[model samples]
Target chain A: MSEKIDRRMLLKATAAVLGAMPLAGCDLASQDPTVRGILDSAEELTEAAQRTLLSRQSLAREFPETAISKHFRANGSDNPDDGDYQRLARSGFADWRLDVGGLVDHPLRLSLTDLRAMPSRTQITRHDCVEGWSCIGKWTGVPLGGVLQQAGLKANARYIVFYCADTFGDSLDLPNKYYESIDLVDAFHPQTILAYDMNGKPLEVPYGAPLRVRVERQLGYKMAKYVMRIEAVESFGHIGGGRGSFWADRGYEWYAGI
Target chain B: MVRATHWIGVVCVTILLLSGLQIFNAHPALYLGMDSDFAHPAASIGVAQRGERKIGVTTVFGRSFDTTGLLGVSGRNDAAERAFPAWATLPGYQDLATGRRWHFFFAWLLVLDGLAYLVFSLASGHVWRDLIPPARQLRRIGASVLDHLRLRFPRGEEARSYNVLQRLSYLAVIFVIAPLLVLTGLTMSPALDAVFPFVAPLLGGRQTARTIHFICAFLLLGFALVHVAMVLLSGVWNNMRSMITGWYRIKPEGSLHVGEN
Candidate 1:
């Protein structure tokens, strides 16, 4: 019996080892530079296909009017402790200005009043959170594309970066700072806007009053609250993590298409 | 001891099947702190709060939770959630949390049991002998791959404990499916990324992980179905008794014999 068991064990060990070796080999194959390059190219092509394959106007799920929680938790910094932001808040954010520059034919530094006076688009959309909470609200804001067109995006500008007043840096990640960006396509999405009023009232300080982002296609982290500056760049190579956001640097996927 | 071990494995698998379904369903198991203004069907409290204030389909959570203008997608409010029936849609938070806890608990049980079995089998030499296929198996394996996959067990003592197909399937389930489930679940937890920042990037993204998890679950479900069918078709009472009492009572041609594990 022992001899028979020994024979069986030997055969089993050989088979098991042989069975697993190929998978490890496959892993090695994947790590090969040429293979890696091919895969990366496939991923890029897939992203491009995904862009034009589906209409950006697809509607997401909307919950009942009653599902709105009484208090939506303010996720990040409620107020900027920065002196400039504090002064603007003290003056009711009337003097806050949104500077649009970088790779733009026309750089514009417009006051909050000027932004508010521009033609606006209102949308009732759901906010999918990284923490998994979601809420729907009526947002009234100027279209982001109009602002970009007004500033006149430079021919080489491929993406727009939003720099906020309140720095939610180091809170979500070890040392990564909080910032967000969007490509030219999302910058022109119909639902995309520079919001000023939330629900039905003038935006409050905690809500990025005077101006904030309203990119309606991705998860919550891409929304850079607090209006201050917008920069358009061709590449994110020098940024926190090439993905163009602080959370992206901390392993959050930049294209949170959820 | 082998018969006893088989019986124990059977019992554990059965318990796992039942509890796993309950946890996945999450309905009718009213634990505290599980009230949704809108719960999933598998959840009584997930879709709607215990005392829901409204039944309308257009529930709007306030502006704060709205990803729009508040940490939204690509700076656009990512309003994208998978479509669900008006009555069935739920808050992604509540559903994910409770579903996760239940899923995690069962997952731990599966992992622990699987690990313990591995250790036991290794110590007992069962892994080397009983679980592995032979070299001659490759020779018999070549011509009719499809027939083997249909699981046409040859017959009698020549039947062997398991065939090449079974060996491949079991190995894949243990190595591939189990790890996929674990990694995908980890990818979804935002906090998990803080300590193990490699998860989402490794899996591509949170949504990508979710898609992979679903695929893995389907694979496991397929394995379970084939396993149950094979057991039932072979000899229900014999298989059941072998797992329950450890020694299979083989009665052939009016003679009774007990097979050694």
Candidate 2:
């Protein structure tokens, strides 16, 4: 293993030194138009490489019981602080309903009991935040694929957009309401779930109570918290800022597999 | 070829550093353990305001230091606190998404460029002949370090060949730091975690990998600074020309090169 690592390092160093060779002679490649074009297309190239390495169904690592962190620090909007969310939380989320609408054959509204009664899965997985932190917890909820199957996604549907109750930047406006989206490839992944339980108990408000979508393969931000609805859409063109998610709309990469 | 690669490295590394700092500011804390808490961090750096003044604070293992103006406090009159100023970051704003895009895009270029450099250097025997110090230089490596410290540099034929310190530093950056940075970076991704599960434990966990990544980046930066200083002191025109046109005007013997220790 050590020898292999050494060989790899040698190759990389050699390549980096060799990589510089073209710059001395190729003025055309250095041109702004050509460089911009390469940068634009590089995203797809990287995405393809990652997907090719791991199958879509590949499972994220699951930790042992003892590995769970004592304190999984709350990030972004820990609490909605809105009247509707507060009311639902006070009433044990009995009145809360998950509106599954948009480009689906059957638009269903599911209560927490209905979701719990459905076939479920529980797995201990790590939540990797883009901000460079991680936490492990056991999540229990129904698979998002199962729910989507029940709702019967329309043939044209290209994305699964999760609408959440949490609002950002001191506004309850539509644009501020936190929303995230995932394509069908991720939507149907076996590990993807709408979790209601955390670490053998009900999820606390700070950790997205009632329910949240867990796209385990992506970063924590992709796991839309405080989810109130799931919408199957052909495209996210009309979504806030025409970007797939709230953070994506701001400046984050919509495909945050890293 | 060498000059082109060196300059590309310069631009990419600059983008990586500024954008990376911005990304670090988002959380502004690092931990060594398997798990972490807000109440205590192994190390934390952030900004706060006190009575019309903004302060950048860095706390390491419970000890705090005031970083202030340089970090945590923006130069703008509004006094809004940000960990790193906008100018240093890629988009010149507190946008992680854009910062990441810039970081990743340039990261690929750097790696690809590295690969090309490696293949070419090996084929040309540049690695063994030029980069690796000759066996005789090994015995006199101590003198090389002392000379560097004393601000003395080689001239004439000696100047054309890299000294022991130059060879070692360049080799370390190429063979150690760059690869480690890429591997540690991959370790942080959940998708890659699925593919290479052993990386986490091997590197002591994702957080540890992140800390190491930061450390490696700073080391690279330090190398760059020293490299530029060496270039300027040695002979900026000659050095720049050597990299650009691949023609170095070697000083004649007994030219009396100035030494700055």
Top candidate, metric DockQ: 2
lDDT of 2: 0.82
DockQ score of each predicted structure, in the order shown: 0.02, 0.33
> Which portions of model 2 miss their true places by more than 4 Å?
A1-42, A170-174, B48-54, B74-80, B255-261
TM-score versus the correct structure, for each prediction: 0.50, 0.87
For model 2, report DockQ. Answer: 0.33
Per-residue alpha-carbon lDDT of candidate 1 for residues A151-221, written as tens digits (9 for 90 to 100): 89889999899888876665543434457899887888777899998877898887777788987766677
lDDT of 1 by residue, B1-261 (tens): 444344344433433343233233322211111111223211121222125331212222221222222121111132322222211211122232222222333455556667777777779987667667677775766643666556554455544366666666776876688778777765554334333445655775444564465457667878988877877776777765555444455445233224422
Model 1 TM-score?
Answer: 0.50
